[model samples]
Target: MPLLNSPRRMSHSLRALAWLLRYPDDEMRAALPALSEALHDERALIAGRLVELDDLIDRLAHAPALRAESDYVELFDRGRRTALHLFEHVHGDSRERGQAMVDLAQTYERAGLLLAPGELPDYLPVVLEFASTQPQAEAREFLRETAHIVRALFTALLERRSAYASVAAAVLDLAGERCDKVTLPEEPSLDESWAEPEAFGGCSTQGQSRPGQPQPIRVVRPQPAATRSAA
Candidate 1:
């Protein structure tokens, strides 16, 4: 199987694993390292998206909301966690970059720019500042090695998107599940359904709480109804 294929499988698995981990599933906890490999794929995918998005941000520089800073932060945090996970699982111990990745991920949470659209000029500097603080020697080396892998992945995704007729016909000739083409939604939106109680146990949002950051645990509160007046 392709190396890229593993990440796609893992991404689907991790989404489910992230939700499962919240509720003290011991078996799942034991399985997290294996699950985290899914994130390795996710990180690679995000890196590709980042390269595209960085250029896209420059091209679509019309307004702040055009490419939300929150989206950048979200994508960064997800990739950061996966990177940290790879570090820990591989090292089997803590190290500066692993901790730094966690720290940066948490620092991002503290900023909390998801809902509020802010000026890109204002936030881009902040992102650059954070990036500058990263272990560039390490991250740059890793990025250089993975650049081609990510490019191939994105190329596959683009082909899957644009030349679906030819792609589908080619895949259909192979005589399997037809390798159905996966298309993204016309308008993608965050899954707020996780906000519902059953979906997320405490905090509805995805991703792990940055260590030492305040976690938002939902508390049920009742509000008084308006009293009926003369009809």
Candidate 2:
């Protein structure tokens, strides 16, 4: 809602944003701006979507009883898109964004619809790192990957709804299972302390022991005296 300019508005926005922040599907992302606009202008696309959504809700009322394919599919598709769009929209600063994605994906699965596995993508962290760096090329590539993933997910749903459950499960298993074993360094004794060689002014020399190694010994050398000239 207009980004919460007033204290009251801000409070309202924060609460609403908190709720919206939890969704991360394409529809939610697409719909949020419209939703906000609708709140302001009343004649916004958001109002239109909301009206459509209401109609869908009406269809849902009889669901599995009346069982109209077109009505149900339309409602389901709109709901799905709205969920996704909201997730994407709040994702910018919403702490609940990731959790929302997980919940939304699971919700679809629970409803007997095949959907993508909800495990956070590995590329997500990489893209976040790239975003923090703000490199133009990296940002563009990250956005591209995000769009591809979104498209792939929807395509899977629309084309292979029947195959979705199995595929989503597989994807989740692969994403959640750890493939690499983590090797932890042995803990050091309290008596153990790091030391360095004085020969190199307490710095490591070439081919010295690697990190986590105890310090090396320093060698002592005697100073040479100037020689007196012999007559």
Candidate 3:
């Protein structure tokens, strides 16, 4: 069967996943109803994965705000394995990673989407947000390019038995791919990795404009002053 590729539907899926991946502050909890509504219209495309995410969101909505935030930090921020920055898997502090980041930021700019200061282009949510702006076929092709990264994240989350794994699974589903089991490297100690200054070294500021630094503005060069209309 052909895969689901509704641009509007996929956008909702991406938005929901983006919200879910962020730190679950009170704002996130409060937005659960609207988020739920966004997904409700796309149930058929998402299949059971929608239920899985809705259930997870339901729990987050009812849980104490602080507990929800703590769990998010514990699962995503405390470890590198489940990190949502896609290039971390492929580039890992290499110079190539920096180039890839620049390329992706340029891609977004070409689409007229400017990222906020301090945002990383490889961050899954940001990528999804970019995909959400594309046409259906274009979005799917864009997503397929990163499908492997999503698969890897799904594997790590499943191993940890995290509910957030469902969010990753949903991403694969939207990309029209199945999650495959893969052997992942041993995870380093969270404390050690966090303590290292180089942990986020390469391409760390790829999409960010530093505070007080002039943000790169996109300018369109004026067309050669309209060919002189010599009467």
Candidate 1 runs further than 4 Å off: 1-58, 62-128, 133-136, 142-192, 199-231
Ranking by TM-score: 3, 1, 2
Per-residue lDDT tens digits of candidate 3, residues 1-231?
Answer: 224554345777678778888888878788888877787775634556777888888889888888888888888876767888899887776578899999999999999999999999999999988887887678878988999888888999999988888888877777877767678888778676655443233224543544345555589775554544432
Predicted structure 3: lDDT:
0.79
Put down candidate 1 lDDT per residue, 33-135, tens digits, no spaces. 4434543444423443323333432322332442443433343233322221223222322354456545545665555532224312112223323322334
Worst 10 residues of 2 by lDDT: 1-10
Candidate 1: C-alpha RMSD after superposition: 19.6
**Alpha-carbon shift of residue 76 in model 3 (angstroms):** 0.7
TM-score against truth, every candidate = 0.21, 0.20, 0.79
Best by lDDT: 3
From the highest lDDT down, the ranking of the candidates is 3, 2, 1
User: Lowest-lDDT window of 10 residues in candidate 1?
Assistant: 167-176
lDDT of 2 by residue, 1-231 (tens): 211111111222222222232232444344455434433443211233334433433333333433444432443344322223434423522346667666645644554544335434222322232232333333333344344333433344434342222222222221222112122233333243233346654344323654456666789775555433331
Residue-pair clashes per candidate: 0, 16, 0
RMSD each, Å: 19.6, 21.2, 12.1
